[model samples]
Structure formats: structure tokens, C-alpha cells
Target: MTRSPTQTGRRAFLAGGAALLATPALAQTTNYTTPFENSTVVERDPSEVVRRNISSFRSLDWRPYFSDTRNGAVLVDTTSRALHFWSGDQSVYKLYPTSVPLTEELTRLGRTEIVRKVVGPEWRPTPSMKERNPEWPDYVGPGPDNPLGTHALYLSWTYYRIHGTHDTRKIGRKSSNGCIGLYNEHIAELFGLTNVGTQVLLI
Candidate 1:
């Protein structure tokens, strides 16, 4: 199958990044910590920032949101940079730039229902990751301060995940330790709707 210029571009970028990751120079990985972690990634007045970030991604209200009627599924139109949630055959929610550049595969960011949802999650630091950041906390229960957030939809192939963040500002920007983060509020909603076996594609 023929790939588009955009696909080729993204692929080249990822390949280059992977090469960098494999480099002996960058092979020295470091444990990532946020202001939230020292403070447990939590603070007062989360709603104000959460509410604002929600609007920043797309100028629509997320609460009474709409999704598609497409088999309780999601179609992340990477080309359009939009995230469409379908309930059946109709859309109940459509969020845009609610998006980021897809770096891994499948040309997108968000996970599906199967691989996207987990409860009472643990933060098992990977061998490589731990080697880099020996200070990273061991696996802990799901909560506001937990690195996994209240709920997590782990990516199938690796330790990477599409999880929640206390740092709401990270949403529109491409800032993360390789995971895709949503505000705590949005993730809470996802927790209620998604399941453990949900499939998450990153094209």
C-alpha cells in the first residue's frame, strides 16, 4: 500500500527518534518527575485549570458532549487531528486538537476501549526506566498523586500509556515522558466508559 507524504514524514520522524533512543549517548535514560509528583501531581483548584484546558483543546463543552453512533468506538482522524467518539452509528462527542502528532504507530494518539482502560493501576517502573530514574516510586495504588493517575488505558505494546495528568497545560503541547495525557476530569469520564481489554491504536 502507498503511504502519504504525511505518513512518510511521521514515519521518518519516529524512526529518527527511535534511533536517538537507541543511541549510547541518549541510552542514559532519566526518570521523569513533575511538580505534581513531588507534590504528588496534585494541588488545589484542579477544576479551574482542567476546565480551561478542556476548552483549549476544542471550544466545546466536554460535559454534555457528543459522540458518534459508530459501535461504541473511536475514530481518531489523524489527518484532521480530531478525536471522534461514537456511541452507535451517530457521533456523541467530537474533539479536535484533542490531538497531538502521532509519534509511535497507527498514525494517532488515543487508545481504543480495550487497551485504554485500567483500574487500581500499578506504576511498575520498567527495568530500563528504573535504571534511569532509580528514584521513581514503586507501583502504587490508583489515586490523584499516583503516576498512573486515577485510571489508565495502557498501550498494548509497551510501558507507554494514554493516561491522566495533573499538569493540564501539557495537553495541547507535545510534552510528556512518552505517554499521552488528558486532564484528570476527562480521564475520570473515560474510566467509567472504557474497559481493560479496549484496543488503543497509535497510528
Candidate 2:
């Protein structure tokens, strides 16, 4: 059967993820982030600050990743902070710079699936999450500064989401509290294509 765009993305991601798994001998298994400059993987703590400025930011973007429409299923490797939308032959990848919680909770739930999608997602901050530094802006409008922009794909693994960030400058670097962030248009497009049962390779 001819696979859909999302399906193509999922296959490509799985292929890459499989290769990533098998190439432990060839590929560098111990990847490090400047965000974790002085920290140890074993010492990851959500409370521990691994990235800076992300403590408070002004704008976010999602237009880049959603440049094209999704086919059917997509592969999003959170550990690598990359999103892959596979089209049968060629594949598109977008890197999202985010700081994951340096904690067992996140590590233990790595490489999981992305179950659902949302557009112009609403925000609901936890009391504790809000207490941790408290600079996260209250619900804001989409485009250039909205924390949750045009779309947000929710991960069933945890309350975390692969969402569009108002802060696009942070892409390709570590800077989230354990969520996959994207830019407005990018995620908006992905959200439109993504559906239930779509695979999300967290890495």
C-alpha cells in the first residue's frame, strides 16, 4: 500500500531510529548538550537548571518544520530534538532545541509514541511547574511569542507535548522543561496531518 506522508515520516524515523539503535558501535552513543555543560546524565533533575534564558523567553516560532504537509504518520526523536516528516522517498527533518528534565521520569520514558494532535493549543500550567522559577508567561496569543502556538501534538507517555514555541531562536539547542517544541506554522501544519496512533520516536 502507498503510505501517507505521516506514515512515510514514521517509517523514515523508525528506520533512522533502528539504525541509531544498532549503530551503538559506530555512532557516538554519549551525546552531550552545552545546556548540560556542568551536569551529568545520571544527575538530570527537572529542578536542576541545565539551560539558561529559557528560564524566560520572549518569542517562539513553528513555521519552519510545518513548511510542508504531513503524509500520515511522523517520527519525532525528542532526545535528538528532531522531527521527521517522511514522504516515501525523501524525508524532511527539523531540529528543536530543548532542555529535557534531567530526571529519571523523562529518561525512563524515552522513545515513546505521539498519540494525538492539537491546533492553537490552550495552556494550563501546573502549580509546581509554575513554582519552578515562575517566569513562564500566562496564556498568550499565537505567533512570535506564544509558548504554545498554532499546534501541539500531545504525547500519551506523559503530560508533555511536541508543541510550537513562540521562541524560534531556541530551535536546535537545549531549552525546554522536558517537552518537544516547534515554531507556529511548522507545528500548525504538522498538527493538521497528525492523528491518533501516530508514532513518535522520542529517542
Off by over 4 Å in 1: 1-71, 75-83, 96-113, 195-199
Q: Residue-wise lDDT of candidate 1 within 46-132, one digit each (tens)?
A: 232222232223323222432432335444433333343433433344342332332443233544445545665666766755575
lDDT of 2 by residue, 89-171 (tens): 22333333333444435343444446777665676555655676366554555444456656777887666787866644444
lDDT of 2 at 134: 66
Off by over 4 Å in 2: 1-72, 87-108, 135-145
- Cα TM-score of candidate 1: 0.51
